[model samples]
Target: MTTPILLFLDINGVIDVEDTDVQGENLPQEYSTVYPVPGTKEFLQVIDSCSWIHPVWISTWGKQSQAWNKWAKTRCWPWAYPLDSDERHQALDLIGHGSDKYLAARWYSRDWQHRIVWIEDGFWLSSLYDSSMGAAVKWAENNSNVKLIDTAPTVK
Candidate 1:
């Protein structure tokens, strides 16, 4: 059986700008609205070339799946489907905490322990606390099978 590959994506900072930055003479305006960050589309294309890649959006706005769909369509970020029922419940459980990224990781594909990759900007490498969940995050952080792209835009 082929291992299922899960790609966890973040919205705000990873795919879009979190805030503005002051440059020498030109102030960089923040891209507050949702859109794929630089090189994101190319990255998605590369993953898509792989037959096992399964993309999943892991963001605080996951509750607003519709909004995310619209944004994805606009930016053309590859996606398979909105969060599944189990993932939705998991996200609901993490409501206000900035730990939604960690919560989403817990809701990865059923066989994700074998093959999974989380790509996001908000996830803290050392902040995961839940034993089972923490192990999973650490596995991704340490293993070559997984990757985390901190897409926080650079001020120019």
Candidate 2:
């Protein structure tokens, strides 16, 4: 049997994004509006059809399991599994308080960085928490699989 692909997924800047005229950005970053990024439904349709792609919710937006699952179901977003607050907090402790999303995925994927496919926005962003963090993200980007989704121009 082939090894199934591990997909670590994020909510904001991905399926959800800064709403344009139709909607407004979530100031609190709660993403309550539920404006899906352009082509998100189509992308998820393809992803869900692929038996190999195993997507796991790795962002704080969906840290709450029930809400996240509900959101996924409402939008028909492949119904990815969500990491609860406890699991997310434990992973955060490993890398300290910061926005290094790849690190969080690392814990969830069980250090299977190279094999896992991470879909988030941080890798494409230029800012870095520290030299070490920058290096780590760089290393993961280079080694692990990543799809840097740019939701700059939201599709109306």
Candidate 3:
């Protein structure tokens, strides 16, 4: 049987929107905190119950991956994988004046390309909209993944 397809998650706008300074610019620090977005925990619970959903973090903040892992531990969010150094570099390299969606997309697993589903706040959607990987990216153009949720009370 084939392994489950990976679901790539973005932290800041997708999970939580905390203040962060990236290259002297203020941006969402999506990975440094443990608190989930409004319905994030519940959404994750559903993903956890599903055997086919392999959730993974795909954020620009490499420095916060460990912190995020620790946070995930409390919720048992199954954040086990870390992006490779090359992938990390690719993400960091995109930190510029504009959105980094395309740059982030480039860091996706080429081997498991279609498996990725980005959950970000549309920061870089337009730049990546026409890319071959656009459909894989989800969420509102101006909202965080967490904000897009309508709580289900519990994962069913």
Choose the strongest candidate by lDDT: 2
On TM-score, who's better, 1 or 3? 1
lDDT at position 116, candidate 3 = 46
TM-score of each: 0.50, 0.59, 0.47
Number of the top TM-score candidate = 2
Please list the residue runs of candidate 1 whose C-alpha ends up more than 4 Å from where it truly belongs after superposition: 1-4, 18-32, 39-50, 63-98, 125-147, 152-156
lDDT of each: 0.51, 0.55, 0.46
lDDT score, candidate 2, position 10: 71
Q: Tell me how candidate 3 scores on lDDT.
A: 0.46
lDDT of 1 by residue, 14-127 (tens): 655533441112112322344444555466556556667666666655445334444333333343234567765765574323333454465454445655666655344333
Q: Model 2: per-residue lDDT, tens digit, 31-112?
A: 4556666666566666767777776666665444235444334333332334457866776777555344545655566655
Ranking by lDDT: 2, 1, 3
Which regions of candidate 2 deviate over 4 angstroms?
1-3, 21-31, 65-100, 111-114, 124-136, 141-156
